[model samples]
Target: MTLYLCLPLLAVLLQPALCLNCSSQFERTPDNSDLIVDCGTSVITLQINLCTAHWAGFNSSDLALNGNHNNSKCKGSIDTSVDPPVIHYQLPVNDSQDNPCRQSLQIVDEAPDPSGPFSAFSSIQSVIITGYIDTPRSDQGVISYSTDLYYHFSCRYPLEYLINNTEIVASSVSVATSENNGTFIDTLMMRVFNGSDYGYGLSVPPTGLELRTRIYVEVKAVNLTGNFNVLLDHCFGTPSPYNMSQSEQHNFFTGCSTDQRTTVTSNGLSKVARFDFEAFRFVQHRDQAKSSIYLHCILRLCEPTKCQELLSACNSRRKRSLTPFGEESNESATVSVGPLYTAREDTPSAAAYSNNMAPESAEDDVTGLVVGVVFGTAAAVALVLGGWFALKKYYRV
Candidate 1:
């Protein structure tokens, strides 16, 4: 019995020594005074407590087991927790006035961190712009403003006028978006046309007026992971004036004519012209952004006739007339009848002639006396009148 028991113990210790076809090797290590076995392979190494259980057969089925074992294989996998890109934008802090002539305006933007500041989880792929032009009450005529995100990075758009009350001078768009160095820029322009032209037989000059331009900027950030975010900013241009040229001035004034009753004709009427009154410029400082200029335009109207009339009236009052029919007479004279004349008889020189002959002779003497007195008086008055009487007599003759 003693020999058999010793044989079994020896066999137990020698089992690990058997020559297996497997090329892998098993090594033993001591941990806390306990010996552990490490099985090594090309793909993985597994640790086991030699005292717990003996090695079983290396069946292919064991490789399929999902549980932990002394000898296990390792597989590779990919990490998908990558961080996204970032985006940012800068613009003028102040609002801008309206512009009628400019079809486009530039809007500046700044980005310190192309990977963050605005969006940390994505890259900025494009920017969208939208808004309307404000028609200020101070504006002399209607103005039309338009915007295009594709052509202009700034909110600058064209401006125009409306034919009817329902016509819109403002417009919006989502046309195109641009990506530049992880930063986005946009532009817009405005237009203003003449609405009314009054006729005064002279050319009308362009009328200047004040208007407001409003714009909103939105950014789209798309990341490598296909994620995105949108940020918005409200900016404005300064109030600008619509300018007019000499030719435009002519078209404005003579383009329309008024009837005797002061009725105006509309067929030859033309649109109004506008000009920018304020200057617009972008201001940049170290990392911050701000608007340095205001959007605005001056207003003017065609009024050559009015100016000429004013000048003529002023000159007419300055110099006095030298002719006899002077300004005073021309202003005060009236058409009427001339002075009247009456006939008179002298005292009957009666008694001298007694009967018919005496009466007749008396009548003749009386007439002659009256005529002499009248002639004498006339001669005295004529002498006093002098040249004036002579001229009057010549004209009468």
Candidate 2:
């Protein structure tokens, strides 16, 4: 009976350490810990960095007029009825790490094991105040000198699940040569068109087509020190201006190849993965007559551990598997995307053409003389007629 009574007391003590609203792997301190509010002339910058665990997912929608309805995700009110109108705003734990305004938190390592020489886990479970900051006022102050400020404490967990760890880079991209194999050859063939031009005495048929280039996208994945698969969700080469309808921007691709996406698997323990993207067609931009291919790709990084857990949970529910890509597979996906790099061809400058002018031929000289003589005679006649008309008009007047 004494042990049972103590158990209730122990549970009550630990309850305060629990995260607010959302479930997390670590114990969470109150959001008020290490909180500092700096109210500037135009903006309110709230800094909260001292929590053992933190929740950084508060969104802009929570500040709506009726946004705190029922005091669910967030709570607060504005008292316009009072002098200077006290605005009571409470932060909520409704946002996720993938939120655009959310800041990135780095994982901290705990103390080393006393009994063993090795350290603890790769990362520690802690509350980090690395996430979005609420800028209440962008152009003017929301809190007046007499306005009262009453905010609440809010936090949540599973810090590693945030979108802060993924990174993608495009190391190199070039026109795919013949050695890349048959598919490239086929793609090149489709883009090439047979045309005729006789620059000299010789008549030769030339293959004229926009160059079909391939992009190499590298992703700096996280926790993927093991076997995993990388999926290229979408890739499109966008011109600098989206509204550009030039031939190079629009006519390169046979169709929207990005719509038919594919996946690739990295077989061993690798932290860096490479993806070859060839869905986009390359055409010369009008600016310099050099083709600029701005490639953007959305990549999904998947591993086995999280994939299995999500799969099991979805299966137990007897519902259709809600995979990362909404497929039946157990791939916990994190998105990394970018306009990796632009591929452009070299073109000669206008100065080069001007400097390489050819000497004038006798035929050209004769054409120039005839044109000048005709213009000179017409100008002289027009001047004489103008003088006669002026004199006639003056006499009549």
Clashes of each: 81, 7
lDDT string, candidate 1, 47-162, tens digits: 22222111322212122111212322211111122111111111221123322111222222322133222222121122222221111122344763321111012232111100
Q: Rate the local accuracy (lDDT) of all candidates.
A: 0.24, 0.32
lDDT of 2 at 312: 58
lDDT of 2 at 66: 23
Clashes counted in candidate 2 amount to 7
lDDT per residue, candidate 2, 1-397, as tens digits?
9999999999996563342333343234334543444322112234333122223222223332222233333333433343322224332222344322333333333442322211221321222223232323333565543221223322212212111112113222222222110111111100110112211121111221134333233434433212333333333345442222322232211111212332222211234433343433244343443333443333333344533443454347633211111221111112222222233444558656555653455568889999999999999999999999999999999
Candidate 2: which stretches are off by over 4 Å? 1-210, 222-231, 241-272, 277-287, 305-397
- Top candidate by lDDT: 2
- lDDT comparing candidate 2 with the true structure: 0.32
Q: Worst lDDT window (10 residues) for model 2? A: 181-190
Predicted candidate 2, C-alpha RMSD: 26.2
Provide TM-scores for the models: 0.13, 0.25
Provide the lDDT at 348 for model 1. 54
Worst 10 residues of 1 by lDDT: 158-167
Report the number of backbone clashes for model 1.
81
